[model samples]
Target chain A: MGKMELVDSDGAKLSSALNRIARDIDAVFDVLLPVPDDTRAPLVEAMRYSAMDGGKRVRPLLVVATAEMLGVSRDPALRVGCAVEAIHVYSLIHDDLPCMDDDELRRGKATLHKAYDEATAVLAGDSLHALAFEILTDDETTPDPFTQAELVRTLAAASGMAGMAGGQMMDMAAESADYDLHTITRLQQLKTGALLAASVEMGAILAKIPREGRSHLRAYARDIGLAFQIADDLLDAEGDEEKAGKALRKDDEQGKQTFVTLMGVEGARNQARALVDHAVGHLGQYGEDAAVLRALARYIVERDR
Target chain B: MGKMELVDSDGAKLSSALNRIARDIDAVFDVLLPVPDDTRAPLVEAMRYSAMDGGKRVRPLLVVATAEMLGVSRDPALRVGCAVEAIHVYSLIHDDLPCMDDDELRRGKATLHKAYDEATAVLAGDSLHALAFEILTDDETTPDPFTQAELVRTLAAASGMAGMAGGQMMDMAAESADYDLHTITRLQQLKTGALLAASVEMGAILAKIPREGRSHLRAYARDIGLAFQIADDLLDAEGDEEKAGKALRKDDEQGKQTFVTLMGVEGARNQARALVDHAVGHLGQYGEDAAVLRALARYIVERDR
Candidate 1:
């Protein structure tokens, strides 16, 4: 479990791992958010609707893969993965709200606000947000109080004003204001890169890796985060809507400048591939133990959705 | 500072303490939410606008007063207070959204969504929610990692589906459902009571008070929490908008069931007074040192706004 034994650095293994982690995460959410037999039932139901099954569970996979590579036990790794996934799911729910992206479709279904009302959607996102910290701070997540505190701090900072939400604010602004390449890069780093990087950093923290020891992991995460966003831009630009499971060409529709818009599809694709290779290179020190992580990096660019 | 040796538990002294704590909470927000010179500036600005210089700062006062009663230091108490207040303010921002209460005025000024756009308001609320956990888990909040983890667990539980948010969901249902007094009481307990109780509980946690030792304080908080809500219902039924600093009588307009509606104005007023008295009674063991907490309980029923 510590080294992902028997798993090869191939697309098949990565796909299986992704599927496994997705199911694991959904199970965790089921335990975390039971609908009460009371007036609050709808709120918990909405939370479950959005959080239980959806998305690639990429953040959770990142956490578990990184932790397992670093010799952490599977139980703790999976719990940490669930915590990160909860935050990711909550963000998606909020992002799809009418006042925000106003997206009707997500994860191949109507968004939370469409399935429930806007109020329930808002509360559901909030409850899931709280649930993430709840899971991280619970004694069962990890016995070490220090690790719990660190996890809470890391996730909160990444999700707040200077991280995902801030990045989203910048994205909202991009529709009206002209953003240069640097500003857009910064925005993407905050919006998506922050949480992605945090997912890896949290695994390192759980493994008791010192701050200095995390530099390579941080670098690996940074490269893949950028690559992931680039690939997302490419997907939004040209990937099939059915395969992607959501709307595409949104940046174009909104007239927002994206990596694809700024660098052209060919330029963006080349950049993303280069980043994937560079990211995989960072894991060379770990040899075979980092194989899964290496494959994850490649999968970022190769995945159709 | 722990004993409040020089101050008596008079109304004037309580008034001064409230004002002092209000300023202290504002100062903390000023430092915690500085607007960066970037695209995220508007988001931070909106957070600052909503989180600072408003409300009674009652939650923080509860934290500080309770912690001080148990001999916790002022600095840490203030930090914890700020953390709880952050959650409270964030909830207010979301509660006032168009999809929720659709409030135009709050604390005598335009609500966050009215002052800024709906999207900014949502992000600002979300950022502050993250900020609360960020503050709670910071080493500066407490030297003890255990205390940090405990604080996070307490706040998250009180803020999530089973606490404030859950209570809010019940309130939403009251608009259409025929809520009896029992259901309304249960709703208020989750909505406002949980956070209020947590404020006291957090102070006890900071002081390392054993769980058994916190029963009296918990009782005190429960009584005050209900009294606070009853007082709110009373104000909504008959209080002035200018004095209350928000639109009142919305409960009557919406035809929602509330304490006042369920128990009649006189019955509700008497119940609040009785609860305040009972709340103060729970502090008898603390003697003169519990003066501030007792005053707070009394103030819950007596405050006009």
Candidate 2:
């Protein structure tokens, strides 16, 4: 509750937790990718490069921290976390393709299509998508087949229609047509929030937490998910490209509607802060066990990139 | 079997069964596609056009027929069949992309990317891929979650790095390099046979048949898979495009080593005939329950297109 405690937990501890998860997930991907690669060298390399390339491991950390709080085993949690990252990265790769957003930079490096060919980029994304399901259904993901099926169903629903892909279609349409705040909010919910909400809920799914028990966590995730996008829009409007590791000012250049454009920078920032406060409040039941997630909700809105 | 029975079964009966399955799967695709016609019209339309436009739906028929013979309930079997068809159609849509085979025609119609734009085709394929896994893991796919999980695992393994995608990488590389019979055969096995084998195996899985009991069926699928590719090569060499629907003589034009190129036309035909016989012989244990499959193997080799 005190200012000093907030500074210590929110700043140093959050960064430390993020770093630890980054290392663990990178190791998971490293060991999991087949060695002695034959014909799949380019595809495998593209997958590894896109997935393991140093983006912030926010989703994985959410999976790990929430699962730990719920007393779930670290093994299945880590594998599930990696699967989420694979899907996330695959989405990024496809979103960056020439026929899509066509951005040349990602993670401070050339996008997959820019670095590799379009065909390899497509295959890498496609292969990673399959691998995510493969990992979730593997015996190593969970000994219980029922739990594995649940994860597969959860992720497939999160990433498919009425979810990420559907959100992307809405987004593509947004560039050509006029959209108000509600439509943009719905678009953001589908495009960005679906996976983020799913990521938080995965911790509960791994622990087999009851629906009622996890509702507050879902509330927390939904709040921060919107907050995350507002932060993204703020970054695009005013942040530095070197820090963000991708292009900035794209929304403005493309004449796309964003939180900043809709609400003004100051208003958008205030709203994001309000969302983070509500998100942190939803963790009241978890007490000290949710300290990391509490700090993350705050850190998410406050991060520079 | 009696000679008169073979004559009755081979000609009208096989075609009739194929027609029946083709219609059933088309109906399955029809009801499955969401039709509110909201923001996802383009994506939903693309998915419908590609999945329902037209194909043999051989994979779906394989799933339905084999499961029916195994006494598996029709509901789950039909859903699994649709899932397999979805995966197969997704592969076809992606394969016809400008970056891949760049084909203009499929099933006597313009390929998806040709009919629609490239990005829509990519999303359609990607969405269908996820839909396959989604359908497999859904509660509607089966009452037992374990069986559903097994289907997810099987389909993912058949389509990912060590399977179809890996095979595609090899196939792309083949254009730039010289490959022998063994390499091409391995490519064909992974590219085509893995999915076919998985399709046959799904029936056994749905029936809860043990691995040992399904081994002969797996063997049968493997043999016919190779025979199917050989027959394809012969079609590419000598068949009419109007009948085949897609472009012909592609293997020769691309200078790819195929069964017909490695073995003479007569030699390839003989090998395919032998494989069909072996495949049918493996089903001896199933008796008349597997009559459709036996006729299918022979028909695969005998059909001109």
Report the lDDT tens digits of candidate 2 across residue range B228-274: 98999899999999999999999888998888888899999999999
lDDT of 1 at B205: 98
Report the lDDT of model 1 for residue A180: 84
Clashes of each: 0, 0
- Off-target runs (Cα >4 Å) in candidate 1 are A1-9, B1-9
**Candidate 2: stretches off by over 4 Å:** A1-4
The residue-by-residue lDDT of candidate 1 on A160-218, one tens digit each, is 99899999999999989889889988999999999999999999999999889999999
Scored by lDDT, the top model is 1
What is the lDDT, from 0 to 100, of the residue B300 in candidate 2?
Answer: 85
Per-model CA lDDT versus the true structure:
0.90, 0.87
lDDT for each residue of candidate 2 in A126-216, tens digit (9 for 90 to 100)? 8899999999988988878878888888788889867889888888887787788998898898888988888889888899987688899
Give lDDT tens digits, candidate 1, residues B1-305.
64354334356668888999988988988888888998789999999998888899889999998998889889999999999988999999999999999999999899999999998998899999999999998888897899999999999999999899999999999889989999999999999999999999999999999889999999999999999999999999999899899989999999999999888999999999999889988988998678788888888887888
